[model samples]
Target: MQNDASTHPEGPAASDTPATPDAPVAAFPTTRAKGCPFDPPAELTRLREERPLTRLRYPDGHVGWLATGHAAVRAILGDVRFSSRYELAHVPFDTGFTGELPPAPTGDMTGIDAPEHTRYRRLLAGKFTVRRMRLLTERVEQITTEHLDAMERRGPVVDLMEAYARPIPALMICELLGVPYADQDMFQRHVATSMTLSSSEEERAAAMVAIDEYMRKLVMGKRTTPTDDLLGDLTTSDLTDDELTGIGGFLLGAGLDTTANMIAFGTFALLSNPDQLAALRAEPGLVDQAVEELMRYATIAQTGLRAALEDVEVEGRLIRKGESVALSMEAANRDPARFPDPDRLDLRRKATGHLGFGHGIHQCLGQQLARVEMRVAFPALLTRFPTLRLAAAPEDVPLREGMNIYGVHELPVTWGEAGGA
Candidate 1:
């Protein structure tokens, strides 16, 4: 697998506007606006307003399309004419991998198209269905409760990130994949090394090699032992040991980090938006909508890329073959055409159909699992500590930088005492 990423490809909106020659090529956004941690970069909003689908200049000097309008982005994501294959793509923003990208490795479904992708998707779909994810809710709650109990015992002051947010999804994914929870620390270390732009190519390769070997061992073990996890269940399928290993590694990495960020970053968003928080606390049933709003509001998996396989028109603009389109999921989520009063953090809004998880076929495979985790975990955290507030000022909390996923490095939180939700 090239890299584990979150992608949502859905339908297009009719309002995709054409770009004019004099219009400046949109640059990939790097900074959030001052004082508003929840909103997309101002430049993104401007571009979305002026040219929903505009020219984007990549660092490698390739001129491509930037799809910021909600409709256009969803349309592009859903249209099979745009290939998700890495070999066909150009880096929308410079996150190190430049020039012509290598074809996706075997079993990395995100970077491939059509028949191969269909096969992997077909095999894994049943395991992550809504019914299956709903079943995991009880397990998610147990894991969440364990962490919350730990945090309360430790003290009022804690980095809720490490204490509460990170562990819940990690435990769930580990259990589902039949990976020993004892080895999560090791998995995290290698996964971290593999993801960061600063890590040397050798380090990244070594990390992959280590992960590949470990997964292969796990697959081999499952083959002989046939335990009761996702991997164990898949062992009965016709997939070869190599294919299963690749998938196991992919699922293991893809499952945790994004949901973990949603928990931490979603909390930061709620704390920052007190009115929304108060409203939810007053009526805990809104947790479902609250989770949806938070997904739209925080949008942890911020950006995605796809390339055109054939000449096709999206909105009013023609996308020539071989050209890439850099999708701003954050900007699309905030599109006023699709979302009323787009910038506000209103938990009461029906925030379903959000591109925060992308749309169409490649939409996040574990999104159901994520929603279940967040729906249970967020209310539990809020209820357990009604007075929960950020220990450090929101501005002081360091945001995850240069990474594909958006979140805080740590969330220092404190509460006065237990109270009713």
Candidate 2:
């Protein structure tokens, strides 16, 4: 299937003189201000305003394009001409060690271009259809209630990230992949450590091998017993053991980390905006729109990397073949032309073309599952507790700095004992 990319008109005219080719080179992966935890790095936002498509110098000293505008980023994601091949792309910000890149591991659809990606996506597509996701709603509601109950039992005050945020997606993905909930901690720890950018190469490699081994075991089990779950469903397909294992690893890590952060960050964003929180509480019907607005407002996955397969023209700029491009999804979602008053957190706004779940063939496969989780969980937490607020001072909530995934490291929260609506 041809996934449609977000198509929005170009934003206001480029600033006078445009980021003069003489403009001082700003490092990629710029830092966000502590005071403005919800905003993208000021430098990145400024880059968008000044010249959405400008030069980006990678750590290895390769100068490429950075697409911060809605149109430009979407164009890159939707176009097959830009390669997602693992070895060809440049790491946007890291200044650490360098070497030749290996091909994307089996089943990692994001790392490969067409044909292969098309095959994996086609096989997995039926498993996450809209109907199937909606059918999982009752179970999601049950899971949310169970966690909320646990929080109420252990609370008044708790780290929502630990007690609420991470486990919901963790358990859901485990259930989908036929992973035993008892073993969730093992894979959870591995996935978490793997996401830490500061981790040493040895540490990252170890985590990858550990998770892959665990998935290998699960895939072998499915082959023998073939219980009814996503992994089991795949066991009947023509995929090899390596491919099955890789798919399991990809699905679990992707489903868990991204959705977990979204839940936590979305909660933090809503809590910081009391009026927005109240509006959501008062009007239950607004859940779907509110989810989209929150996603656009606080995109958890910060950036995506793509390398040019061939020279391409994007928004009047000529990107040469083999040059890397960083698609700043955070900035694209906030482009003024796409979203008026782009910085404001307005739940009622029509955030139709936001790049939060991404766009094109690589657009998140499990987005509907995420939407269902948030749509059910958010309201359930607020309505059940009636008095939910942050336990720590807003400024003191530890942010996950320098990580690919953006979110609060710990969300200390308190709520009244009352459980009734």
TM-score against truth, every candidate: 0.92, 0.93
Error of 2 at 216 (Å): 0.5
lDDT of 1 by residue, 190-240 (tens): 877776666766798899889999999989988999998899999999899
> CA lDDT of 338 in candidate 1?
94
Q: List, residue by residue over 290-336, the lDDT tens digit for candidate 2.
A: 99999999998778878776668999887776777788999999899
**lDDT against the true structure, each candidate:** 0.82, 0.82
Off by over 4 Å in 1: 1-26, 417-421
Q: How does candidate 1 fare on TM-score?
A: 0.92
